[model samples]
Target: MSAYRPEFEAALRLFARASEAMKARGFPAPILVGGGAVELYSNSAVTTGDFDIVTPRQEEFEGELKQLGFTKPVGLGHTPLGWVHPELRLGFEIVSATVLNGMADRDRLVLIDLGEDGEVAIISVEDMIADRMGQYASGTAPEMLEQARQLFILHGDADLDYMDRRIRHESGGDYGVADLKA
Candidate 1:
């Protein structure tokens, strides 16, 4: 009954399986971040070709991925350390050992229940917007600003005070929560 794209659904299912496997092996579940989080929060208004995750235990996580049939590309042409599932054609990359390089508030992390698929943890909307703002402030891409605006507009109930502090921290005060409205 969910209106999410097939890719998104598949990705979540895969993430759930991986999380369960990791838990069974005594490793903490990986946190979903980057474009995957953006796609999820955007309600498929945006799409990412790959999924990015954060986990302190990279090697163990990769092992779990391999057990899940995600294999590393043979050559250096692809994303280093990224794994690709041949049949699903989905790529997964572990972007960082810590969530938002440890800048994000642990209390703000959102846990989404997938019913039988288990649960997935994602960065809060405030942190995601702040992350985009930080990317824009760094002169990396103007699109990040637009994405932040879209998220702000869509998530009207977002905590502005938290966003303000997070944006200031992420952008080094180059951008603020007010800027997201602009």
Candidate 2:
């Protein structure tokens, strides 16, 4: 069995439950994105307490989570609405769409069966790396450089060419995998 961190496992469970609830109520499932997707793609090598998801219908998605016992917690800073599980500290950052730092629609989503009518949708590994690299390039987050480097070293199969193109395009030729490795 593959090992997952406790925080990720909890978030996956919540995502599964939320997906089922939304489907029953006629809502489309949200695409799992951001750092949580990194954790999932990296097989928990990278972990976060929060799950970031993007969907066309944010209000409906959030409503479903609220109906499923997730509450909007305060002091999370600028996230529109930060929902948390009643018992666990797991947080959800539901957003309108995939933020286009780069690597848009480059790969397919991988679904993980969580058992019982719950399936989790994860962003592609390429896109996940793009997300991290985007953060690194923007100078908003210096630590994302290390995260991108770790992902590059840890996931050998990740497409270096694609990542290089994305980093250059999004950063206006400022950064690349070479920078991460150096």
Candidate 3:
């Protein structure tokens, strides 16, 4: 009776496995980011076909993924860093070597316990909303605005002040969390 959708649960399981392997290998755990964080914070109202993760130790992280039965498909036009677990049929990309390009507050990262599946680190809801706003401000996609709005509306417990500062930083003061409230 897990509340999570199948896709999200699978992603979490895979992330936990990879993270555990990385820890065993003496590497920093990966930070789940992008659409995966959105899906988690949005209660699956927002869904992504793949997960995006950030880790300073990409080489070691990929090695751990390999040990966990993930493979980079050959000649499939996938990004060099994209890896898929065939059984799960879901893939993830190592989007960046640094977490949120080093703009994120490491203190704000949340750890989700997956019981025996281990745990995964995710960006804070405040940071995620700001990230979406940043994407919208950068003209990446109009949907990014809607994603920010969705997260804002869903997480009432989110710290407005923190989000405001993060939004200003991410958007270069072009937008703020207050704008999403409007």
Model 3, residue pairs in steric clash: none
Clashing pairs in 1: none
Q: Please give, for residues 1-182, the per-residue lDDT of candidate 3 as tens digits.
A: 17669867986887999998898878888999999899998888888877899998888888888888889987767767688888776788889987778988899999998888898999999999999999999987878999999999999999899999999998999999779987
In order of appearance, the predictions have TM-scores of: 0.95, 0.84, 0.94
Best by TM-score: 1
Candidate 1 weakest lDDT stretch, 10 residues? 1-10
lDDT of 2 by residue, 20-68 (tens): 7777778767788877877776678877878888877788888878877
TM-score attained by model 2: 0.84
Q: Name the runs in model 2 displaced over 4 angstroms.
A: 24-26, 75-80, 99-103
CA-only RMSD, every prediction: 1.3, 2.6, 1.4
lDDT of 2 at 85: 84
Error in Å for residue 89 of model 3: 2.5
lDDT per residue for candidate 1 within 3-117, as digits (tens), equals 6788778877888888877887888889998888888899988888788999998898888888888899876578776888877677899999998889899888998888787
lDDT of 2: 0.75
